[model samples]
Target: MAVPYVKGIMPVMDQRVYVHALLDQFEARYSGAGGQFRYDGQAWFGSDYNKLWLKSEGTVGTDGRFGDGDHEILYDRSISRYFDVQSGVRLDIDHGPTRAWGAIGLQGLVLYFFDAEATFYFSDRGVAGRLTGSYDIFITNRLILQPQAELNFYSNSDPARGVGRGLSDIDTGLRLRYEWHRKIAPYIGITYSNMFDKSMFFRENNGKNNSGVNFTFGIRSWF
Candidate 1:
C-alpha cells in the first residue's frame, strides 16, 4: 500500500518540503508559554499580472505538540499600474475544526501591498470569523519592514463540545528583512497578542494574554 505524505503515514514522506521550524517564548501575567514550529509553501501559475496560487501551511505546538493545517488558493488580477486585486478560498484542514473561507485584497507598489481578509468558519465547534490587515514599509533599497494585525470574533461554543467562549483575539507583529538582490534576505521581528474570553486553541497558550519579542534570521530569494 502507498502511504500518504500529508498525514505522515510512510514512504511518501520524501515528497514533503521542509519550510520552517522556530520556537517563540511568551510572558504573560498568569503564565508563560512558548510557540511552535511552522512549515508553509506556495505554488504559482498563470501569466502577466494574473495568476493562480496555491498555499499550504501547518503548525505544531511546542508544548503539547498539537497540530493544525491550513490550505488556500487565490486568483489575482492586476487592475492598474498601482493596484491589483485578489480573490481566494481558504480551507482549514484539522480534525477538531474545519473551515472554508473567502478573501479579497489589494496591492500597491510604493509600500508593497495593503491587504485585508475576512473569514468565516464552518465547524461544530463554532462558526468563527476574523479580520486581518497587513502592509510592508520599505526603509531602503535593501531593507523592509512589515507590521500586521488580526482580530477574531466567534459564535457561541457548543454547550457540550466546544472549547471557545465566543469572544475575540487581537494579534500584532512586525517583520524586518535585508535583501541581497531580489532573492536572498535575513529577517527578524516581534509580536504581542491578547486572547479574549477563549483559551487559545494551542495548549501551550493557557493564559488569555501574551507578549513577546522574536528574532528571525532567514534566507529568501528568487531563482
Candidate 2:
C-alpha cells in the first residue's frame, strides 16, 4: 500500500479588507416624559488588524429636543485575539453647545463570551471615562435575551453641560429579541437609567429629571 501525505490548514485571518456596520439600537422609547426616538450604532472599515471606527448615539423627544448626541471617530488596532486598542476624538454635537474630547480606549471581548469596552477622555475641562458591556443568552436558536449596561464618570464638573464630577450616571436594559434572519433582530425591552451622587443633585438643581424607566421596541441589524 502507498502512503499519502496531507497539508495542514493555513492561517488567513487578517489578509483582506472588510466593512461592517451595526445598528444595535434604533427604537422608540415610551416613558412618563412621553414618546421619544433613539439610535445607537457603529460602522467600521478595514482589515482585521487595523480599522477606522465611527460611533454615534442620540435621542430625540416629541418636541424635537435632542439629547446625548455623542459621536466618536477612532483608529483601532487589534492587539490580541480578543482585544483592540483605540484612539481618536469624541464630539458632543446637538442643538446645544458642542463639546469635544481626545479619547483612548480598549474594546474587546471578555471570558470568551461577553462584549465590553472601556474608554477614557480628556478635554480642557477635565477627564472622563465610560464603561459598557453586553451579553446575550440563547433561549432558542432564533430567540435570545440580551442584557446591557453603561456607566459614565468624570473628574471635574462641566456646569455648561450640567455634568457633575464623580460617578455620573448609569444606563441598563434587558431585552428579548427574535431573529427573522441572521442579520436582523427585533426586540422589546425595558430600560432603567439614573444619574447618581452629585450628578443627580445637579440635575435636580437644574430642574431636570435625574432618572427614567422606559419601555422600548426596536430592530437591530448588521451587515
Candidate 3:
C-alpha cells in the first residue's frame, strides 16, 4: 500500500515569508568616567533560503555625543545548515562626515555552536573589517550565561571620526539572565572596552584613557 502524500502539509517551503528581529543589546553602561547607552540588533525577512537583513549598533559617548558604530543593509542567502553569506552596504554617520562602504561577510555557528561573524569593508579610505562572536552556556532550562566579544580594524585612519589605522578597538563582556518567557530575558553583565593608536582621540588632543570596565544591564528579546 502506498501512503498518500499531502503537498500542502509537507515540510518543504514554497512561497512563504517570515520575519524576525532581535534586540540583543539595549543597555546602559557605567564606568568611573561617566555613563552611556548602547544598542546592537538585527532583523530579517524572507523565505527559508533567501532573506533581507538590516542591522544597526552604536553607542552614545561619555560626552553625550552619538557614535554610529555600524549600520548595514544586506542581502542574505542560506548556504548550509548553520551558515549564511551576506553582501551589503554600510554607512557610518557619526558626528563627523558620513562615510559609506561596500561590505561582505559570513555569519553562522561554528566549533561547538558558537555564534560568529566576520565582515569586510572597502571604501576610498582603504579597507576595514570586524569580527564578533558570542556563546551561551546553559545553567538550567531557563537560565543562561552569554559571553560576547567584538574586534574592529581599519587600514587607514579617518581623523574626522577618530578612527585609527590597524587594530582599533575591542569590546568583550559577559551576561547572565533567565528566560522569563521564550522571547524575553533581562540580564546584567560587565563589559570592557579599549581603543588604541591614533584613533583614541576622535581628534588628537581630546583622547582620554580610552579604556575602561563598564557595568551593563539590558534586555534580550525577539518576536
User: Over all chains combined, what TM-score does candidate 2 have?
Assistant: 0.90
Highest TM-score against the true fold, candidate:
3
* C-alpha RMSD values across all candidates: 12.3, 4.2, 3.0
Worst 10 residues of 1 by lDDT: 22-31
Over 1-223, each residue of candidate 2 has an lDDT whose tens digit, in order, gives 5435456855465768999999999988888777778899999999999999999998786767787789999999999999999999999998667999999999999995899999999999899999999999999999999999999999998765657898888888899999989899999999888887777776677655527999999999999
In candidate 1, what are the lDDT values of residues 152-190, reduced to their tens digit?
666764322223566555666676767766655656666
Measured on C-alpha atoms, candidate 1 has an lDDT of: 0.54
Clashing residue pairs in candidate 1 are 183-220, 183-221, 183-222
Per-residue error (Å), model 1, residue 192: 2.6
Writing each residue's lDDT as its tens digit, candidate 3 over 49-161 gives 89999999988877877775788999999999999999999998766578999999999999999999999999988999999999999999999999999999999987778
Stretches of candidate 1 above 4 Å error? 1-32, 39-43, 48-50, 63-66, 74-89, 95-113, 119-127, 158-167, 201-223
lDDT head-to-head 1 vs 2, winner: 2
CA lDDT of every candidate: 0.54, 0.89, 0.88
Order candidates by TM-score, high to low. 3, 2, 1
C-alpha-based local distance difference test score of model 3: 0.88
